[model samples]
Target: MKISVFAITATTIVAVFAVSGSSPSAFAQVANRPVLVVSSGVADISTLDPDRATNVGDVGVVSEIFNGLARFAPGSADPKEIQPDLAEKWQTSADKKTWIFYLRKGVQFHGGYGEMKAADVVYSMRRAADPKRSSFAADFAMIDKVEALDDYTVRFTLKYPDSTFLGLVSNYHGGSIVSGAAAEKLGNKFGQSPIGTGPFVFSQLVTQQYLTLVANDTYFRGAPKLASITYRMILSDSARELAVSTGEIDLIGGKREQRWVKRAEGRGMNVDIFNPAEFRTLFLNRNIKPLDNLKVRQAIATVINVDEIVRYAGKDVAEKGCSVVPNGYLGGNCGSGGYTYDVARAKKLLADAGFPSGITLRSVVSNASAQQPIMQIIQAQLAQAGIKLDMEVVDHATYQAKSRRDQSALVFYGAARFPNADNWLREFYDSAASIGAPGAMSNFAHCSVADSDIRAARVEPDPLRQLMLWKQAQQKIHDDVCAVPLFGLKQVWAHGDRVRFGYELKGALNLQPPITELTTVTRSAP
Candidate 1:
């Protein structure tokens, strides 16, 4: 099991086989070349196919190699304004049920694959929607059909008016376009090794150690500045810090350790801090006892001091979170402010709900160092309320599997992207979102009331009316204690001074990195 890190960096570089020699001279010789070394904090690159990937770490890599029809510009805190990637421009019908897109010309897939066409976009959408593929298609479930009107023009028909349709299309995995022919030829292996029309091309996979990519001169947007990028898998956070400090690697991904963050800044290493519009929270399975009772759930939520946790996590590392809907989400009503840290109130609620002394609650947490503190703090707080929490920590893979099965009374996890309140409400409260389902994504709470309110918000298309509906949904979910919201994570990364890139403090880490905006900086003769 590797500790996965999520962030976006861009470049163009050629692939070169490293000579098998363990010496500083070998590394220093290559240091002059434009390269970024990342600790593959996570295991197996898994599927390079964005549509199939659920982990944020995987998406970070996928975003580099693939070009979506539309992309969230780097530094876009809001989802309403999306910049072009593959598509030059797009328009929506006045009724908001139809969409038309114009594809960029002269864009070719890596490896001289072929020219990108409108048919490819249509095929990709169909593939994403196919039941056999089983990607995160529910977000696009409202799309009734997709058709190529011309060589560069494509149209999308929706089942109903959806204001969030464009935002959904810009989703990390939702918007990745795969070649129709490649999908058929490679079958399942298509995910392991994907071909895209982006700035980088897949070169070689060296098992668990690392993956190598070369620059695509034929990239539609423009030629990438770097010649190559080597992603090294560094599982241990300490090892990653050491690698970055010692110059063994050029960059470190995801949130860095507090010690490393300070060290990197002190050393003049570029430290990018990004605040994603998402939060980590404790999800309560309503089917379970104690948590099933609204008062007990609310009491538990009120007892935790989020500000204290944020302070402990480190300054500029995290901010206080109020609700499932992130602060800037469209049509979102942020949940009530500040957790009321009242042990007396918690005790009374637990006792009133017949969950008094000797009541043991099970909490399933992911085996990550970052999450450990949160669990420990909650356990102590719950104990004071007369609730004994049995902490069960599992590896990431097992944690992800069990979470979907709803096997725990409580689960602590984070949503990678929460661009809109719909994502928040839909996953936690829709009937189809329940753990036991043909389309279950992450509704581990098994919250039926939340599901109803979320459904109502989804169907309401009027902007102001939709906001009202979403607010009601959030309030209802909060009032019912569907889940206890934690704090929003502030992403931190460490990189060597040689590399240059921009970081978006909101949305996904990459959006539009410096690679797309600047020329590659070549090493000057020292």
Candidate 2:
């Protein structure tokens, strides 16, 4: 599909449309508006609902189509740079348990919905707090109440003081405010047809093919430079790279390998290797058979060489992950170091655990280019220590499902959160978040070794006390061998020379170079 550049006026309204596979060419007819066709390494999207966004593709699209009370400044992923969005300003009580936000009046929602108000904020916050409606319910577990003080004002009461409260309401994850009217009217269909007050409006989604979003002419931050964006699902790396090289697509998620980065640059494409890196870690399921033994878990950790993995991944795109909290995040405990890679130590540990001959571990792995290679390297390394890794290779979606269902003895997963220790520790290391728990999120290891430290760190008002608790939690997880922290793979993307993101690509919380209001495409370029 193709689109060209144009302008929107006060009298003009862009219509949101969806088409079936039969009408694949519908977007090609959009007269003068240019379309930025981006390629994601997924077969399709699961949902467009901001509250339930888990996949990187879904979050990237949701980031453009929605707005939270506060937002990380455009072109940067640093939490310290977060600024007001739908909310004009905010203040917290002396005890830091109560918060008040003043709304920006007259801001219109997409799809003819009425102006946003304090009630919508209250509704969205309450929706996020409900586990049935959100995958991020744990993020708001501390919230006691959210109320509309007036049409232009909203207030929040927390069960305990949290230094990371600002991040809980920022434009990431469940903090994205939904249109209360749209949520009520659309109901379950809201995921398919989302309406928010951002620079982009959801327009068309041709499943397995492309999802298109048109510009919001009445965007609070003014209109986007590009007329629209078409996120195309291209599962093949070589094919996607070819498409971008031939100018068939504006941008494509590049393979997370050093050679791939060099190859793209050689082809004269603009390669953006941005943060925060998805910290890759192999979690030994504490609930599983052999993995339940501490020596077995420590043996597995010792055999894996994170330094070799980083070298294989191309040092430019990967960093040695030192702790569970990841290196760049605030309150991260990287100074403590990680498991030393020693084949002899691994063999000794395995023998001490009563496995002198050999031991085999089953793991579900994603076949995506970014993951498959890393797993393969680990498998080879593990074999040297008489540890056989029986990897169940599956598609990314299937891998995620199986790992969460506790189907694998080992879960090798990677993710980039909001750059905070509490966010990572609470969701992955807390006992309340273990898989199969009543309100489970992503604790694939079924790990509870650091639950006390994680919990204590959250409400610890003393800055040093909180920091120490976070470090203690990480140290416990590491010493207990709950998971082996591997390497952090930075996001790799390549774009055509004609496209300009209008900002230096540094980091994006969505794990991609976000196409924002300032991003533009020179369609007339040869």
Candidate 3:
């Protein structure tokens, strides 16, 4: 949802009165004061560019300055229950092929970019669909057309009925709206200096240091409690923990390493560990040797003890993943309940697949501390099945590029957002979504079963019937061993007492904090 900065002035006045004695001068002093020092993790955020930001760090900064058609409140983590942002309310056709959104009026873009208009929504969606624009939201190719019905209305026509359309719009990567006039004037650099109707206006951004934002008094939503917010970049997790402990920072995003959780909790800090709507999995490249065989894939999947990995990773940190889709996802049936930790079956499968001394499979993974132990466990498990596994760890950016380029035989990865059954399943499996293709988002498994099932499910409209088709598709994905299901990601964040905001366990990291709901409490004199 869109958050206009216009309401800040009025909000500050009320907030000050509510907290301190209702003296005008005292209220002014509190209103002008900055409240929180937030650690936004490591990454350069100088460019307020959303399109180029593939990392979570950049998205966090961009989210504060920009907004989309719909948004989520911080305390409420449900991605499905999207509240009014730019659009007050919307409706879908009976067939689900058409969607009409009613826009909120009188919203002004930051930096006097322009007034909110239906044309702007149309322009943003069209630009995202355009190949030349290079939007991360290009996966929305499922949409056939977007039309501006009027100054305060926009309509979307899909190729077919898609129950997941709203979920797709909630994707923070490229779903945030941009002014058409600004895009025309700035061209490709429009993303670098985005102007939106959010609670915060872009003030200054420094690389690998901090992102500074000032409250937008012209925000349409109620003004933010904090006069200003600085997203400080802290590289080391320990340093981040220290910063929060010493009251140097206010909040720490995402899950921290297990060792730091206890230390942070000991300091009387609130450690929020929630079940996220994302899943992590191991992708088996069918184009690669050994993994090309279904038996080899099944052997690998059966050998790896997910329970053991969950134990090592910290039980509270993750849930065991049984299917490609996470447990709470729409159309997710947790698979046919077939996967089991049977080392004997793994060995037999490997032998039947022509592995005398096991197959040597190359596995690539990101350099996160949590991932290292998981990979080691997988390696040891494979060895028990007579499969010799070689592990290669690389930096996150390098790993992402390598996985996309299809250079790795087997790779460990996760989906950042859950966009219904269609986008999540079809984009990753449809034959049209092979690596290097336009619609491809996560097709690392390279399985024909995924391709066939996605094609059939797309045309099915009946909700119950479509779910059955998706179930079959998931079962086929499991049987093909396209990718070994791993576990659901547990979202954990730490916050100092000075800062207060709500968040959910879905969408991109930035989408969680409904900027309007963010409140910065003053420190009681200790």
lDDT of each model, Cα atoms only?
A: 0.68, 0.85, 0.69
- How far does residue 421 in candidate 3 sit from its true spot (Å)? 2.2
Alpha-carbon deviation at 354 in model 1, angstroms: 2.2
- Model 2, position 440, has a per-residue lDDT of 96
lDDT of 3 at 488: 69
Judge candidate 2 at residue 505 and give its lDDT.
80
Candidate 2, superposed: residue stretches over 4 Å from native: 1-31
What is the Å distance of residue 511 in model 2 from its true position? Answer: 1.4
Please provide TM-scores, in order, for all candidate models, with all chains considered together. 0.88, 0.94, 0.87
lDDT of 3 at 2: 75
lDDT of 3 at 403: 82
Highest lDDT model number: 2
lDDT of 3 by residue, 185-237 (tens): 88867656677777776655556666556676667876667776767767677
Predicted model with the maximum TM-score: 2
User: Which parts of model 3 have CA positions greater than 4 angstroms off?
Assistant: 1-31, 45-48, 51-53, 134-138, 254-259, 502-517, 523-526
Going through the candidates in the order shown, the clash numbers are 15, 4, 21
* Candidate order, TM-score descending: 2, 1, 3
Error of 2 at 424 (Å): 0.8
